[model samples]
Target chain A: MDLFEYQGKEQLRKFEVPVPEGRVATTADEAAEAARGLGGRVVVKAQVQVGGRGKAGGIKLASSPDEAKDVAGQILGMDIKGHTVKRVLVERAGDIVSEYYVAFLLDRSERNYLGMMSAKGGVDIEEVAETDPDAIARVHIDPLLGISDFHARKLVFGAGIEPRARKGAIAMIPKLYNAFVGLDASLVEVNPLILTGDDRVVALDAKVTLDESAEYRHPTFAELKSAHEVPEQERLAKEKGLNFIKLDGDVGIIGNGAGLVMSTLDVVKAAGGEPANFLDVGGGAGAELLSNALEVITSDKGVKAVLVNIFGGITRCDLVAEGIIDAFDRLNMQVPVVVRLDGTNAEQGRKMLQEAPNERLIPAETMLGAAEKAVELAHGGGA
Target chain B: MSILIGTDTKLVVQGLTGREGSFHGKRNRDYGTDLVAGVTPGKSGEDVDGVPIFDTVAEAVAETGANTSMVFVPPRFGADAILESADAGIEVIIAITENIPAMDMARTVNYIRTRGNGTSLIGPNCPGVISPGKANVGIIPGEICEPGPVGLVSRSGTLTYQIVHELTQRGIGQSTCVGIGGDPIPGSNFIDILEKFEADPDTDMVALVGEIGGDAEERAAEFVKEKMTKPVVAYIAGVTAPPGKRMGHAGAIISGSKGTAEAKMEALGAAGIRVGRNPTEVAEIVQELRG
Candidate 1:
């Protein structure tokens, strides 16, 4: 569950981390007004989960209210890294004496929480790791001991913060760590964890990715979920309790099992077309889920074609095929659906699909062939 | 002849008073496993499918002398079940519950590692270990399995069955098949099971099933490259999976530019592990490797 920049900043503020005063604005006038409230020097940052927003002109500096309005106008309708800028975070620009990156993630091999802090934090951590590997400092936290003052101090010092700011960095570490565990975050990142000219440490930017598995414990957080920010198809899928995440491509996919769905995605890419969404119906998913899934994919205006890949085990392939046929009938879907069904009763499923009256329901012999057919149909081929 | 369960393996069911427990427990008993006793806290002297339910795993182990356990406890209480069974000196334990919290798993896995006292755990979300024609444990569909020499290890439960069914269709019977569960932190890893397959003379070749998360497959590939003399055929699922969206299991999320199907496949390929494109290909690859 990726939080918008404004939401992440709000979480940081709760932990007493100094973030620039900001307000989210949906319109240019609102952004201009927010900039005026911030005394005119502000930054307009497009709110999207994807990175490289700065390079894509999603981040703009405004020296005056009018400039803020102009910047917002330019950004509001612009596409940044394939995501449209629907909302912009208008924040009072701060002085950055230095920038650093800090994040926490689970290290499976170590079987503990991993704390990574880098002197070079403003850019992608991947770039930092690839180019200047020595710039990043990695620390493993023992679950038993948890994060301690000493550990925090060592990490801060190791990240190469100046001696003068080391104490403040140490002070901020525990606060960030507390927010991470308290908020059930899979990733709590402060990219460009800034040092202001006033000798104050502030989180200039926040990118938090929460763990949905811990949703049962955080009811308030569940309410804070921003489905409006997600793509239209995925938002609808979520409402129906279907697991869906929209991608950038045109081929829509629905499958059972995480592994199978992913493998299906690869097959699509291998077949010379990009996938538009990854939808998993899960094991033991019945007609209702299947119907919702197909509706979710076919409803996508960007989807040129659809693919259903199932390796039925406990859930029978024949039942899934029945659901697909029923969904096609109920919705009167016009788009092409290429299905690749295997495992128990798969042959029966293929026969059922083949006998279906709809010409759009094409059954493929294998995953690769299914992907190829989906790609072909997506390119406006087939009956 | 199997790594975990076989004819000599005496097994008991945990949370046997529950419906799922009784159901799978009955299946294990009917499959001719040495289903000796059961454990359900404060359910002592109760009978579940004619299996005596004890108050705790210690009592069950003491009475039945069962050295192996198949756990069907709910997610919340799963950690305690594993600890209890481990404390009872069980040789092998398999947990079949899904969605055990990360924090709970971290603590439980750490404890199991430190205090396992030579005990081995198969899963917290997996279909338990099965030795065809000998014993059955966990929730794997038994109809797909037949006693033979090929070994199978997987993360996805249903996919494991699909691969096994395909294998069975091709007259390829399994030696010992284990599901390591899809959770990020599983009890047993690929290396743990691979070592068993490597050492078992009955096992001719191993079929490895992986998914689009973590470096588990890469590690397994490393294991196959450096140590194993027998052939390894690997298939990583979820190539079409969207980045960063975890639908099936919490631990199955793609994070930090790693754990992609492409990455896992490339790693496995570099290690000389024959990568199967689909479930049906797994058996064919293993067959080629066996020769």
Candidate 2:
């Protein structure tokens, strides 16, 4: 789960990492009040998960409370890369001598934690990686040993940090590492870890992605989930305990596993229909879960047809078939559903589906055939 | 003739008294795997359908000479379960527990690697290993698989079943099918299984099932190009997956410009491996290669 900039900063502060004192505001009046509290000079940053916020004109420097209010008003409703600005971070403006980048993330290939630092910061790191690879210094930290003083020194020296800011950077790296591990974060990036004129190292921008599976340990993270920030379908899916992602298309897909759901989406696309969403009913889909899934799918007005693809292993196809029939009895589903049952007890499941009274339920022999049928139905062809 | 498990695999199950553990354990035994013993702390001497349970892995291994372990513990104690098995010197550990914290896996994986016991760990969220008609270690349905020359490896459970069903329909059987799980940090990778397949005498061509996430597929392609002599056909899912969304699997997400199906397919295709646009196409390529 990605954290908004204000939340990330709050997390950083909890770990003793220095960040500019900031206040989160939803309205222009709140922004003005926050700016006044910060001595009348502030930076109004649009709080969105996506990047390139500054380029999208969602960030601005305010010289006074009035300017802060004006800037916050302009940014609150602006869209940056499809994410609407719902809130703004009003932070005290800083005088930066130089900009640097520092981050700690799971290096999936190495199966270890990776620390990256660069003397050059604030611009796109990937572009820097493409243009000047040597500017970024990467170190793989052992998950067992964690980040030591030696690792921090290596990163500082390798990145060629200026002598004036070396101590501050060195002191700050380990704190960030603590936040990364302590918070169960997949990524903790402080881009433009700025060197203030007074020689203090402060994180200007925080990008933290927490591991959702580790949410069991961090109960406080639940408070950070702003309901307004989530889309309605996604919020509903979460409430129903379904793993779902809303997509743009006509055919709604429901499958057993992540890979199978993704493959279903692709197959639907290949058969000339776009998928409306990716929904995984998980390993065991009972009657109640199936009905809940159908209700969620039909909630989207764009979904013209539904595809239920199940290759049961732990998930019994016969049980799934019963659930689908049960769902038809409970919900007033308008869309035609193309169901493909395979793996465990698939024959019996298909037989049950064939015998069901619902005329809108269509059973196909193969995954490809089922996808084609769903595509045809979605495109207004005969069921 | 299988790469991971065969008739020689003496199996022990962890968390054997639990719901998933008992179910899959009994199914595996019914499929003719040599179910020697089970380990459920405090439930020692108990039996799940005549399979005796030991309190710890060491006792189970000592009594039954169980060399392979199937883990069905919950997410919280999953790392401890794997560590216990490794400590007991289990030669092969296939973990079927999903949602194990990545940090826990990281530490467990590191500890296992640093120990250098040559213990092969397959998954923390996978559908075990099956050597058709020989031995079933984890939860891969033994019925769909037929013993043949083809080796299969995938990052999914049900998707693996889909591809295997396609192969069975086409009369293209498998020597072994391994699901390496869809977590960000699985114990075994495509290259690990592919190298084993390359060395195995019974296996002929290989079918790789990958999805959007990490650079595992891209790295596997490089490994195939450099080392393997076996023919490989690939199918990468999530071609239509949008960016910044987790597609069911925790690891299956498009992060920035990396971990896209298009990129993985390109890498695999560039390595002389036939890239399938869909699962059926993958089976067709495997059939053609086998012929």
Candidate 3:
């Protein structure tokens, strides 16, 4: 959901904010061309989802197009916090007199959308929170009333915008709020919102996370969606209409419901095995859903072994076991599937699975035991 | 006494013409819940599970005198459904849909607060509540629960079943076990139900099963520390989950210091709530507190 700096800036420009001209580059040659387009004095920033790119050598300042190419060559294909560098944002560098931070997020307890602003910027918000929480001005927007001009003025002054820049900052607040709400964004952030030496304000960096749940309303947002942003297996699962989230480690997981999937993930990890994914088959996950889920997990090249953990209360465990058996038969599974069934007719469910063919159907007494068995099997030990 | 639904409570099912709504509506009726009416736009003349279907919540409530509504509306229109039900003066609204946008929830929750009127909301993503031996109003399989003095509350549905199974294995019984749903915004909170548990003399002890997420557990811990006399035992799942990846609960992501399992456990422990490391140990903690 983390947009590239150029993408963020494009969205900002749509809101009529001042931004340095920029273009995203994929290769060293492209970076050089982009730098030339920006008048040959530009900033090369690695296009990764994470922050602290500057500290990680992902951001470099170049005085000439050749220097931009050199810096982009060093950054291209390099890993920044586990995200591969696929693109770089080359922009005209700005002469800043001051930098500030501004963002909007949901505050659950207050049940309101809160706008947060700080005079200090270009650093992680966590640092600001830890060192001086009071430096951040928090403004809650009542949903009924929405964000008003008064609220914007309050936030502008509270964020310590100087007298000269105060009017401009206040004017931008409502536009930013409109963008945040109009885009169905979970987050709309402007980091290092710089005040140019000429008394003009420009957004130097931007990060926006769109709310996926509202994608149904905005058809155009679908073009911006990239499956590569999430786990590979989960992307396929989403394509198949299954809810899946990939985690680190060896144990492949398929459970019913989000809560159960999470608890199963915890139990598997607690038993010293990492969960490969969070796959919830939802309520009444029939044989089709189960088969689709298993196929999705087995398709993953990273998954070593599979764990079929079902605490079937409303959805019958026996049905889930049958689905696993059907999926195993359909796919001719190579990896071991450790089954743990506990709930209504659980013994019957286990008995049903026990009736399936012997080689891939491994049974364990407890969830912990099942996870241990799966991890061990995946690690190359005999089942 | 249950925190929300009981056998004595008159029930109405919104979106009752839908497959899930009709299925659960009939099932709840068969389970002894007084399913008095149903609400589905343009299906007003129909009868679902022998209950009259009305066009609106107001019509249903007025005709059937049903104050409790179990909403099965689809996620896109769920907020409007709940707000409509609330506007109609339904005392409690339990929404069983999943994946409601956080922004939509914030607006709905904020609307309720501003209007100074809100029917209790159980979940946009939850298993609902079961007042054992009384009535069940949710997606949770009812056969797993039994009526007794232990009031059980959890964020995980299957984990709730597992915890109840463990408790039942140890000869403990539950009075009313509520699944508050694992979404970031739930209709009711841990503190909302804990107050009812504190007031119920039949409930001798309370078991709270929380997961890594928002500060709900911390707030609950503070409530139990200040208000409750009965013993409170708790457990937080996904302790080993990686920080950035959501461990399935939409609200379970560890953001800063608030949503980590360690933070939740520390807050609960600091508030004097006996914290269990796993669901298997939840029953043991409750039993020890019973002593």
Candidate 4:
């Protein structure tokens, strides 16, 4: 789960990583109040998951409480990169001497933790990587050994951090690593880790992505999820225990595994249709789960047609067929559903669907054919 | 001559008493795998479908000579299960448990790699290896596969079945199908399995099913270009997946400009591998290469 800037700062503070004092405000009045409490020039940053907040005018500087309210009001309802800003973080403005970047993230390729640091910060690291690759220093830290003093020093030195800030960067790097591992975060990025005028190092911005799998250990993480942060469809899907991602398209997709579902999405696109959503019923899905998935997909009024693709390994196709029939009956589904069943009682499942007497339930032999049929139906063509 | 498992594979299942464990255990055994033992601590001496159960992997290895271990333990104990199997000197460990903490996997994978014990770990969220008609380990449905010269590796479970089904339908069969799991840090990667496939005598060409996320496919493309002599057909999913959103799999997300299907396909195509636009096209490519 991606944490908002304020939440990320709060988490960083717990690890004793110095961050600019900030207060989360949901309303413009509350933001003004927060700025007043801080009693100085403040920056009101729109709390959204996406980047480019500053470029999108979702972030603004306020010299006084009234200006803070006006800026927060402007940002609160702003949509940057499709994410509506619902909250703003009012933080006391810092006197920056130099900007730098530091992060600890899971290096998927290496299957280890990776620490990255750069003297150049407050910008997209990817841009820095492309333009001056050597400016960014990367180190792979062994999970067993963790970030040692030497390892921290290597990043600090390799990034060519100024000698004046070396000790502070070195001391701060390990704390960030602690927050990364201790919080079960997949990524802990501190952009514009500023060297203040007083020579103190502080994280000016935080982008922390926690591993949802490790949420079992961190029960308090539930509080981090604000209800409005999740879309209605996603919230409903989560409640149903189905893995669903909402997308803007016409054809709804439901499949057995993640790969197959993603492949199905690609296939749908190849067949000249956009996928409405990515829904994985997961392994060993039964009739009830399938019905629930169908209900969730159909709930999206944008979905004109649905594609049910299952290559059952642990999941039986017969059960999936039953679920389709069950969902059609339960939801009174009006959308055309092109169903493709393969592996694990596929024949029986096909026979059941064929006999189900629903004109909307169209069974196809191959995944490609099913996608094409779904696409055609979604475009108001006859199947 | 399969790459990972064959008739010689003496399989032991961890968490055998669990629903998924016991179910797949019986199915694998029924597929004619040498299902010798199961490990469920405190459930020692118990048996799942007549396969002996031991309290620990050490005991299971010692008594049954189980060389290959299939793990179906919960996410919390998944790392421990893999570590236990590796410490007990198991040659091949395939973990089918999903949602194992990334930190736990990192530590476990690091230990296994640094230990240099020749113990190959396949997955922590994968469907295991299947040598068609020889042995089935993990949860790949044995019915869809047929013994042939084609080697298969995938980052998915059911998608692997779909491709294998396509192969079987075309009268083209597989020597071994390895599902490396769809986690960010799979124990075995595309290159690892591809290397084995290149070395295997029975395997002629390969079909690789990759999705978005990580540099695994890009790296595999480099490996194929540099080392492998055999033909490789590849298909990558999530071409339409939007950035910043995970497409079902934990590892199947397009992060920044990296790990995009377009980039992966380009890399593989540039490496001289036949990159399929879709799964059926992947099968067609393999069939054409076979002919």
Candidate 5:
């Protein structure tokens, strides 16, 4: 789950990391009011979960409340790439001595948490990595020991941070680490960890991606979930606790496991058909779940055919078949349906599904056969 | 004759009194595995499917002489359960729990590695391993597999079954099929299983199943080229899968140019392994190799 910049900053403040005072404003008047509270001068930043916002003219320097309102008016409606700015973050403008980069992330290469620091900030780290790899200092910290003073000192000295600000940098590194650990974040970055003219270290920008698997612990993060960012079908799927993602085709796919569902999507595409959505009914798909799944798929106007693929292990195929039959009985679904049953009690499930004399129901003996049938049905076969 | 588990493997099912635990415990036993005991913290006096339960893994191992641990616990205690099993001297443990926090996995994986005990873990979200007709350890159905010379390894559960089923139907039997889990960081990689397959005398050919996410397959391809002598047919899933979205598996996403199907296929093909476009096609490739 990616966090908007303001939310990331708010999280940083919660961990006692020094940050510029900021307020999120949704309108021009709100921006002006926020600037007034911050003593007039401010930086109006578009609060979208995309990069290069500064290059997109989504960020502006406002010297007065009137300029803040004008800049907010310009930014709130601007689209940075595909994400439209519905809100602008108004921050108190700062005086900087230097800008430095710092981030703590779950590194795939190390298969561990990595603490990266660089004296060069406010620029893409990838550029620094490519042009001069030595500019960035990366240290993989054992999750057990955590971020230590020694680790911070090593990072600061290694990144070539000036000796004068090393003490403040040392003090700030562990705070960011605490936020990363406390929030169960996969990534927490403070690019442009600014040194004000008074030698105070403050995070000027933040980007965070929290682990959704850790949602059981952090209920507060629920407020950060953007409903509008999700498509209607996807939002509905989330509401129903279904793993569903909308795609652009006519065939609706339902499968038991993620890998199987993914393979099903590929197979359908290979057979010259596009999938309407990706749906993993998962382990415990019963009658109600199946009914709900069918309703969700049929609700999509682009879906012309629904394919139910089951490879039961812990999941019984007969129950799935019963669910499919129950779904047909409950929902007024008009699309053609293709069913493929395998694994536990698959024969019984296939028999149950075959006994259904519904003209729209088609059963394939193999997974590949099922894909071909679903594709064939989606192309021209009608109810 | 195979890797991971065989006739001598004694099993302890953690969280055995719980729903998934007790059920897969029965299924594991019914499939002719030597499931000696179960551990459910406080359910020590209880019996699940005639397997005696213990309060802790140590007691379970001490009494039942269990050497392998299979976990079916909730996401919260999954890492603890794996660690407990490892600390109790189980060398081979498989975790079937999904949605475990990545940080939990990172901490636990580091612990498992630094412990200096050569304990091998298969998954935190995998189907486990099956040594066809010999012993079934985790949840891979014993029915679909056959005792042949071909070995199989996958990062998926159902897709592993799909490929194994294809092999069985086409008379291309397997020596062992292992699911290494599809998490961002699984306990085992394709190289671990490949090295085992290459060493096993009974295994003559290998079928490798991989998906988007991580450089495990590419690294495994490198290993295959360097060490393995047997014919290895490969299948990479999520070809049509879009970037940035996880295609079912936590580890099955293309981050930037890495973990892409095109890249994995290219690496595997360059290593001289025939890369199949789909499961059935992979089976055909294996059939031709065996023939």
Candidate 6:
């Protein structure tokens, strides 16, 4: 899950990284009050989880609390790349002598954590690596040994940054690395590590993506949920403990595994139908879980038909069929339903569904057949 | 005759006393796999599904002479379980546990490589590998597959089954089908399985099922272009997936155009391979190759 800019700074502060004094404000008055507390001068930045905030005029420098309020009024609620800015971060303006870049991220190809630091800052690091690769010093830390002073010094010398920033680079680079490791974060980037007049390097901005699977470990990460960013159906799915991603089509898909769900989506499209969403009931999904998955999918207004494609492995098709039957009883589902059951206990499951014979349900013999039926039903096709 | 597992595969399951472990363990045995022993800490001297349970992999390996390990443990200790099996001299470990923190996987991957004794891992989050009509390892349905000559490798579970069933229905049975798992850092990669499929006499052609995310598919395409002689048909999923959103698979996210489905598809097409638009199309390509 990607944290908002302010939340990223808060996480970095937890790692004892020095960040400029800041407060989150939802309104112009709150922005003024926050700026007043920060020497009556602040930087009003939008608290959306997207890039190019400055280019979009979501960031503004104010000389006084009055100016801060005006800037906040303009930036707040502004849509930046489809993300609505509900809050603004009012931070004390830092005295910047120079800007540097640093980040620690999981490298999928390398199968290791990569540490990247560059003397050029306040821009996309990928662009820098593209335009001038030598400017960015990239290092791969051994997963077992982790980062140390030697690695820090290597980045310091390789990036060709100024000498005074070297001390902070040595101290701060590993601290950022620790944050990445300690938090089980996939990525932690400080784009502009600014050097102040007092010879101190502080993080001016932060972008952190915590591993969602590691949410079981860090309970406090719950508060950083981007509820506004996630749609209502997705919010409901998360609450129901289902892996569901809402789409823009008419066919609601429910499958046992992620890959199966994805394939079901493709097959729906291949059958001349668009998928409403991708929903995986996950392993060992019983009647209640499948019912919850069905409820979540049916709740979407765009869903004209629902396809339950389950390839039982650890999950039994009989149990899944029972769940669908039970769910049909509990919920008022208006959409045309297509059920395809295969794998373990499939014959029993198919027999059970056939015996009940709900009018809303259409049982197909094969995966492709099921997709075709669902698609035909979705596009105003006959029963 | 198969690359990873065959009639000689004596399997010991880790976390055997657990619900999933006991369930799939019995399923593996029911499919005619040589069920050997099980490892469940502190549950030694007990029996799960008539299989002897040992407290450690060392004891299980010592008693059962099992060459392979199927891990179905919780994510928290999943890496440790894999390390234990590797340390105990299990050659191929198929980890079925998902949500193992990526860092833990990175560490185990490096550890296995540095301290290599021919230890190979398939997945910490895969469907395991199946040699049709010979042995069943993880959770792939053993009934749907037919023993023949087509070699299948994929990064998904149910999609692997779907494609294999498509191939089987079209009279194109497979020698072995391997789901290398959907994790970003899988234990075995496309090249590893492709190399095996190329060398195995029982296998004649190959089907590569991939998804957007990571450079594994692109790298595999390069490998196929350079070294492989077998006719390879490929299918990449998540073609309609949004740029930033991860669709189901943890490794199935499009990373800034680097791991897009189009990129993987183009690379495979440029490598003189038939890239299918869907699973059925891929089966057709394999059918034509069979001719």
lDDT of 5 by residue, B200-239 (tens): 9999999999998888889889989999898899998888
Predicted candidate 4 versus true structure: per-residue lDDT over A1-383, tens digit per residue: 89888889999999999999989998999999999999999999998888888999988999999999999999998999988888899999988999999999999998999999999999999999999999999999999998789989989999999988998999999999999999999999999899998999999999999998998999768888652367788989999889999999999999999999999999999999999999999999999999999999999999999999999889999999999999999899999999999989999999999999999999998899999999999999996
Clashes of 6: 0
Order of candidates by DockQ, top first? 4, 2, 5, 3, 6, 1
lDDT at residue B271 of model 5 (Cα atoms) = 97
- Each model's lDDT comes to 0.83, 0.92, 0.82, 0.93, 0.88, 0.88
Summarize candidate 1's per-residue lDDT along A1-383 as a digit string, tens digits.
78888899898788877788999999999999999999958999998878889989999999999999999999997887667878999999988898888888766766678888887868888878988888888888776567988877778878787876677788888888888777877678999888888888888889887766667777757666843466666678878877787788999999887656766777788788999987888766787888889998888788889999887755678888899999999998888888888766888988999899988888888777888899999998865
> Which tens-of-lDDT digit does each residue in B1-291 have in candidate 2?
788899999999998899989999999999999999999999997899999999999999999999999999988889999999999999999999999989989899988988997999999899989999899988888888999988999999889999998899899889999999999888989988999999999998899999998999999999999999999999999999998898878789898889999999999999999999888989988888777
TM-score of each: 0.88, 0.98, 0.94, 0.98, 0.94, 0.95
- The alpha-carbon deviation from the true structure for residue A165 of candidate 3, after best TM-score superposition, in angstroms, is 3.3
Clashing pairs in 2: none
- Candidate 1: tens digits of C-alpha lDDT, residues B1-291: 887899988888997879878877887788788899988878898887678989988888888899999888887788888888888899999998776766667667777787747789888878788899988887776777998889999987767876887788788899999998888778889998999899998898899999877888999998899999988888988776666677477667777687887899999999988898877677777666656
Q: Write the per-residue lDDT of candidate 3 for residues A42-100, one digit (tens) a residue.
A: 99999888777889999999999999999999999889888899899898887889888
Candidate 1 overall Cα lDDT vs. reference? 0.83
Q: Chain A TM-score for model 2, please?
A: 0.97
Query: Docking category for candidate 5?
Result: medium
Q: What does the lDDT read for residue A377 in candidate 5?
A: 84
Whose lDDT is higher: candidate 3's or candidate 6's? 6
Minimum summed lDDT over a 10-residue window in model 4 chain B is located at B282-291
After best superposition, candidate 3 residue A66: deviation in angstroms? Answer: 4.4
State the lDDT at A255 in candidate 1.
88
Candidate 4: clashing pairs of residues: none
**Once superposed on the true structure, which residue ranges of model 6 sit more than 4 Å away at CA?**
A129-135, A162-164, A197-199, A226-230
- The prediction achieving the highest DockQ against the true structure is 4
Please give the C-alpha DockQ score of model 1.
Answer: 0.49
Docking class of 1: acceptable
lDDT of 5 by residue, A172-288 (tens): 999999999999998899998999888899999999888888888898777777423787888788788789988889999999888888889999999999998889987767767
